[model samples]
Target: MTSDKAHNLWHQTCAEQIAAPVLSGDVTVDLVVIGGGYTGCSAALHAAQLGASVCLLEADEIGHGGSGRNVGLANAGLWLPPAEIRKHLGDGPGDRLVNLLSDAPRLVFDLIARHGIACEAVQNGTLHCAHSPSGLKDLQVRHTQLKTSGAPVMLLDADEAAARTGSAAFHGALFDPRAGTIQPLGYVRGLARAAMQAQALVHQHSPVLRLSHGAGMWQVETSAGSVRAKSLIQATNAYHRNLSSTAPEYVPVHYFQCATDPLPEELRATILPEGEGCWDTGLIMTSFRMDQMGRLIIGAMGDLDHLASSIHRAWVRRKLIELYPELQDVPLRQGWHGRIAMTSDHIPKITAIGPNAYAAHGYSGRGIGPGTVFGKGMAEALLSGNDISLPMPAIEAHHERMTGARQMFFETGATLTHLIKARF
Candidate 1:
C-alpha cells in the first residue's frame, strides 16, 4: 500500500513534500541507488555532491517505506548496547562503530541545517525510559557503558524522570543529550530534494524490475527505463520489492503507531516538557514522542493490518490511559504500521552483492542516524573505490533462518503482550 493510504501522521503532517518524474529512457551514471529511503537518498545526495553522476529509483514516492513511518528518534548507536555490540563484533570494530554512531545525531542534524531541510528537527535529546525495576537495572548498565565510552548521558531518578516525562509510570531513565526527534517523512523527502538539487536524478514510482551485474557494470531495469552504473547501493531495508535474489535477508517485524489530536496547551505543558523522545525498556518496545503540532505519538511492536489489529488498537487506547490517566478519554486520530528488517544479531549488514554493488539493511528499528551515516559512507566508499571508509566490512552474503516463523513469533509475542500487559 502507498504511504498516503496508510493513515500515517507523518504523511499528513510532513512539511517537506517532493515529486520526481518516473524513470524513462536509458541513463548511465557513476552510481545507481535502488530505494529512495534515508540511505538511498543520502547516498545519491553525497555522491552527486562529490561530482559523481547518480540516479536513485524508487518504486513508490520518496520516504514511502520505513523512513516515512519511523518513530522519528534520531538516536545514537544501534539497538544493541555497547557491551552487547562488543560481544557480537569484537572490541576493535565494535568500538569503532559505537564511536561512529555516537556522533550520528550530529551528522543528521547538521545535514538538516546544511541542506535547509524543513524536517521538524529537534536536538533536545531522548530518554531511554525504564518500564520496570529490571529495566532500570538495564539502564544502569547502559549508563555505565556509555560513561566508559565518554558519552555525556544522565541517569534520571524516578522523580526526575516523572518530572521530565510528566508521567509517573517510569522507574528511571537514561538521558542521551545528543539525540533528538524530527519529522521523519519530511527528513527523507528533504534528503531527496537535496539530492536532486545536487544534480542527482531521482525517479519515483520507478520500481526496479530486474537487476543484473555484468561487464563490470550494474544494470537496473524498471518497467519503462533502465540505468547502467559503475556502482550500486540497494537501500530498500524492510520494504524491498521485486528483486528477491539481491534482497537482504532478515526477519520481518512490524511496528505500529497511534497519534492523538494536538493536545491542549495545559496538557502540552505537562507531557514531554523538554521535547525529548522516549522509548521504554520493554521487550515489545514502546516509543513516545511529540510533533511540532503538539500531537503525542505512541508506538509499539505489532502489526495493525493483521487479524490482531483490534487487540493492538485496544492496547494503544489502554496504554494511553495507563501512562497518563488524564488522557483516558482522548481519542486517537491516526494509526499506521510499518515493517522492520530485524537481523538475529541486531546488527546492520552491508553485503557485497556484486562486483561493485552493496546492499545495506537490518537496522532493527534504529534507522535515521545509522541510515544517514551508512548511506554517506557507502557513497564515499563506492566513489573512492575503497571499502576502508565503510562503518562495517561488507560481507559477501547474509542469510537468516526461519525468517517466516520468526516473524510470526514476534507478531504473536507482541499481540499477547499488548492483549494482557497494559490493561488499566
Candidate 2:
C-alpha cells in the first residue's frame, strides 16, 4: 500500500486542532519566516516571545511536512559524532556547535514542559544499536568521544543490548541518556500553537511566491499578500519552496517506515520496555521505537511508498522475523515515507542570501533537536541583527537536481544494492 494510509494515521493521531487563517492582505512585521515546520514555528515562537513582531507562512497545514511525518526521535547533536565534527569543523567551531546541541534535548523537553504541549513527550533515553561486530567498534569510539565531552552516555554489551532491545540482532548499543522520543507531528503543531498564543501570526496554506530585498528591508511575497520585515529566515529545510533565487544543492534522499498494530499487554512489557528510541549502525540506517499506544514503528533506508514497494515490504517482514520470531506474524498497520535533504558532507547549513536574510537546511535525517536549536539560534540572530548565532557562519546558496529522472536513478540504484545484498 502507499504511504497515504500511514500518513493519515499519523495526521489523525499526532496533529492537534488549530484554526490558522491564511494571509489575506499585505502586511508588515519585524520579521517574516518562511516554512511552518518545527524550525519556522520555533523561530516565530522565540521571536514573538522576545518582543519581535513575527509572521510565519506555511505551504500547507502546520506539521504537514517532514516535521509532522518524522519518526519522532528527539536526539541531541547531529548525525556526525563529536570526534568527526571536530575533524570536519576543527576544534573551536565544532566544539561550539557540539556544546550547543549537547544541551538541545534538555531545551526541547523543557520547552514542551514549559509550554504544556501535549505531544506524548518522553525523555527516557535513546540507543544506537550496533548491527555488526565491527559496528560495535565504531560505537565504542563514539561512546569514548561522547564521554570525553562530558555527555551522559553508557555503553551496553551484547547481552544488555539484546535485553534492552528485545532482539539479538544487535551486537551492542551506545545509550545516550539525554535523548528521547515523542509524537513528532504533534510537537510541531504544538510549537505553532505556542507561537500563536505568544502573539505571532501563523498563516497556513500561504506559500511564499517570491522574496526581494531593497530599501533596507526584506520583502516576502505570499500567494495572498506580501510581508515586509527587517529580517527574513528560511526554515523550510527539506520542504523548502522555490520562492528565492539561491536554491541550495542537496542530495534528495527518501526514508520509509512501517508501524505494526499495538502489541498485546503481555508482549509490551518485554519490547522496548524502558521506552527508548533506537537506530542501528548500518550505512543504510534503521530505526525502531514504540509509541505511547504500544505500536511498534520500524523505519528503514529505502523508500517503500515512493519506490520498490514490494522489496521494502519484504525487507520489513524479513527484518522483523530476523529480530523477533514472535513478531513474524504481526501485521503492519501503517506505512509511510518522507524525503530528506542531505549534503555531501552530511552536515546542515545556514546560508546567507543577502543582508538580513538567512536560509538554513540539510538536516540529513536528524531534524527534531537540531531543527529547534537552529531555529532558536536563527531567531536570536535575526532579533539581535547579527549573523554570529549560526553554528557554521552562513554561506551563499546554490540550486540542486530534484528532477524525476534523477530520482528514478536513485531508486534504481538503491533497489539494485538491496537486491545484491539479498543475493549474497
- Per-residue lDDT, model 1, residue 26, is 99
- TM-score to native of every candidate shown: 0.98, 0.95
Task: State which candidate has the highest TM-score.
Answer: 1
lDDT of 1 by residue, 248-301 (tens): 899999998889999999999999999999999999999999999999999999
Report lDDT (CA) for all predictions. 0.92, 0.83
Judged by whole-model lDDT over C-alpha atoms, candidate 2 comes out at 0.83
Mind giving the per-residue lDDT tens digits that candidate 2 earns over 125-192?
Answer: 99999999999999999999999999989999999999999988889999998999989888888899
* Alpha-carbon runs more than 4 Å astray in model 1: 1-6
